[model samples]
Target: MVYQTDLDAVLDFPILIGDIGGTNARFAIVVDSYAEPREFPVLFTADFPTIDDAIQSVLDQTSLLPRSTVLAVAGPVDGDEIDLTNSDWVVRPKQMMKTFGFGDVIVLNDFEAQALAVVALGEAHLEKIGGGSAETVGSRVVLGPGTGLGVAGLVHAQHTWIPLPGEGGHIDLGPRTERDYEIFPHLERIEGRISAEQVLCGRGLVNLYRAIAAADGKEAPFSDPAEITSAGLERSNPLATETLDLFVTYLGRVAGDLGLIFMSQGGVFLTGGIVQKIVPALRNGVFRAAFEDKAPHRTLMAEIPVYVITHPMAAVCGLGAYARTPGRFGVETAGRRWRAR
Candidate 1:
């Protein structure tokens, strides 16, 4: 529902916020407008029957009535139901409001919340991947490969920052090398197509390993992605190492393409579980080299900054920020050009 006044202004303090993903659901209570929030233990989505069940467990901790709640879900937020991309829980804002007796509830795409969090992150929360200093007056893009790939953009508009969210992971993944072309056909295609998500997510890690092994006519060990990553990181398997290398390289290429598409001179932020686990591989120059390999605009690519978000609760931080000041986020209005004040 649209609020008459800004929702941020009217919402009560100690707001409940969440970043719900395929594997885990993270929740926090913002007690003060500017203070660090009280967080709950990470809840696995598979353990809960519905989103309501998960929230109920959190409420059981304090037994207090919250003024409002904002949930950052790992999928598109549309119409009445917010269907999770990788989870079974279907979150309905209006239904949730009625069930919980909440004054308001806001649902956002997980990456949309991450895009908001970009403004809240400090130097300590960011690990630089490559590029020069971020542009102070340009767009910023944030994408993450976890259970799924998420893409979003943040831009200043009308004295506020607005989030641009889309399903960019579903786009066809283009190959840039002979090796990539050789392995493309082996990927477990989605809907008879090879989308970026099929090669950039947790399952995608396994897909890469299998395809690489098949191309070389060798048998792949470690049936799952975790085992493959373990073998790759432990330096026990050459095939696994090569698989991860290709994965990171392709990720860099996709990230660079996104940088160009959004003109994200401000920066490109990478988040989510998979990138966090494979950070060492990402910093070894392969990823950066591929990122800046763009023809003609390679110079521009080098100038655009890149970062990996180390903060785990970044989405929660952004949701809290929006909860405190709705009008400041520029999400309520549209088409207004922003100025740096």
Candidate 2:
């Protein structure tokens, strides 16, 4: 959808947009509203051992100095208590402002940035996975599974875009078939009360592997989700392939269900570390079928376009998108504690 933001105002020097994830913090240098953002530099949080150190490393790489910055983080963003969902680098926003000497340092949920990006991204930016011809305006759901399942919705409110944050990834998850019931029991040890996140996200790959293994009357054997995916790509491990396929199928099912719930006529965009790793696997075949396999109401859901966000730096674009939206985020970095609506 077209976002006619007078973003022409975000001058190059003061604006900085960063997407902070569990593993690496992606940073981009912005010159102005219309000028293209520079190549993203990924800084491993582990390399610096602290977010501030990582921030400094990025600044050291870039020549332009930014006065205002928006940090998109992968965790629940509440006031100044921004604890990263997967990592230990907790950001104290007020402290950050004092330390960085920024006039405005706005932090928001990472998925929220992904949602806001929908307004700025066009057809060339998106990779179609399922659904039909898209329109310029409509309600959309932008979510994905990675270190953890993240959810966000883009509601086109008249002339502006309203990015809605949701704890949807934590919503109760249930079994659709008898096989699933058996699978849930095996996961009981780790996930007493299963949420969609349990079978999605990075750790989710392991859950899927275990569930499938348990269903096969065997123990799921993988140290981590990454291992399982690597085995699946190698095609030498039968169990890994089956596990990954089931993960994709279930991912489609859950995303499809979300589309129906939100009536996300605008589109259902799947973006995250999981999809990026399995892009080739998802591009053709069963994944799209499962995404479009909604029963009874299939016709209505089928038309909802689904895209796999190919751009790794789309989140940064999302930050740019949000900055363009007026009254979207109010900033007050008076002190390590931040207060916002």
Task: Please identify model 1 stretches exceeding 4 Å from their true place.
Answer: 1-9, 332-341
TM-score of each: 0.93, 0.87
Model 2 residue runs over 4 Å out of place are 1-12, 188-191, 219-221, 233-235, 283-285, 324-341
TM-score of 2: 0.87
lDDT of each: 0.83, 0.74
What's the lDDT for candidate 2?
0.74
Where is the poorest 10-residue window by lDDT in model 1? 332-341
Q: Which digits, one per residue and each the tens of the lDDT, describe model 2 over residues 179-279?
A: 67767776633446888888888877787787778777876668688889888877768989877777877788888888888888888998977788887
lDDT of 1 by residue, 178-206 (tens): 98889987888878898889989888888
In terms of TM-score, which candidate is strongest? 1
RMSD of candidates 1 onward, in order: 4.4, 4.2
Best by lDDT: 1
Model 2 clash pairs are 12-31, 94-336, 95-336
